[model samples]
Target: MKKNIVVTGGTGRFGNHLKSISTKHKLFFPTKNQFNILNFNSMLKYFNKTKPDIVIHLAGFSRPMELHEKDINKSINLNIIGTANVTMACSQKNIKLIYFSTNYVYPGINGNYNEDDPLKPFNNYAWSKLGGECSVKLYKNSLILRVCMTEKPFIHKKAFANVKTSFMYHDEVAKILFKLLNKQGIINIGGKAQYIYNFAKKENKKVKKIYQNKNMKIKVPFDSTINIKKLQKIVKVKF
Candidate 1:
């Protein structure tokens, strides 16, 4: 059955792909001016107008992981507080909420993390995302997807050979998202777990190899791969 779906941050990288794939539902991608997550009144006002059945909460701070450190306040306000506002608005209307979180919430030391696994955010960026997760967890009618996805064409020239992760392209994940809308709680969403170099080389053979070393300013996870067995059971697609 078709339903009304509102996507926050619909203009963003992942949102842009999601908008392209979501044809079955009455989707609304509200701009910041139209539906600001930071302002509950704005969110509520938009929700009241759209009367959506579900809200895909994707509005948050991401990228250039260092930004989280440089501006902790911005990170907290946008990612944590902004998500909290969204969650509250969704809860008030009893709308199903789907949150896009990151796989970095899990301890990178061990790969193959499941929904039940203990969380240990690798960096401040991950911590802020996890903070958002706290509010979503409180809402019963919600789904949290700890996704590990990247843009197509592999933006980085040098890929880490040792660091392992379940990196799926944004377009790939977007194709499978609608199938998991009814899912509740947390689910690990990504492609086959492999070395960053291998994942990159598949798309760009010319991609150079690099290593994660102590000299690096950012804390790179050695192994942040997620187990998608639960996800496989939900969707027909194999990833």
Candidate 2:
């Protein structure tokens, strides 16, 4: 019998891709309205009924990075508190949990940060994700993916030419996820580190090049590329 896998943010950009590739495992993606992460009882009830072997917790606030800065409460409630609720519910039921994290958790000024490197988040989004990471660590049966994924074809008209990162398409990340579903602990999931504009130009030649200044309103990570050598050896391919 196929094991059941439940994705918390089934309607999210990344979750949608996870749902598409879930063949070996039966996938269950519940919408935010139906499965509110803020409500612990709601998640507990569902966990009791489905009893999923693995829960990919994807529901969280992201994008428009300014939103996290302006609304501290929302960021705390969704990414931090919501993750706590999920962690508590999963811990009680003894279910495996996979937490989606970001490379921004590391200092963006440097490159090639390993999974064990110290974290110095440059923005609120990273802080919120780190908040979630703290909870996942408390639970022994959990995995945290410090993902460096971007939308395919680059969504920006002007990309930062000077900035470096390990960016992967959402589809690519989704394809690689299942191969490591059973693995526990933290893993850096991304492609080789390179200029952001160069990575985007491959799929979008017309994308303009621009530089971001530190004085800007939004705090951006300059070079948050992660070291995925361990992951490469496990997957046996460049991602």
Q: TM-score winner among the candidates?
A: 1
Tens digits of per-residue lDDT, candidate 2, 1-239, equal: 47788899889888878767747788888887668999888898888778899899999998888899899999999999999999988999999999999999999888899999999987999999999999999999999999999998699899888789999899888988888788899999999799999999999889999998868754467888889997897786463
Report the C-alpha displacement of residue 6, candidate 1, in angstroms: 0.4
Q: How close is candidate 2 to the true structure, as a TM-score?
A: 0.95
Global Cα lDDT for candidate 2: 0.88
Q: Deviation in angstroms for 125 in model 2?
A: 0.9
Model 1, range 189-219, lDDT digits (tens) per residue? 9989999999999989999998888566646
Model 2 deviation from native, Cα RMSD in Å = 1.5
RMSD of every candidate to native, in Å, equals 1.2, 1.5
Model 1 Cα RMSD, 1 decimal: 1.2
The 10 consecutive residues of candidate 2 with the worst lDDT sum are 213-222
lDDT over C-alpha atoms for residue 52 of model 2: 93
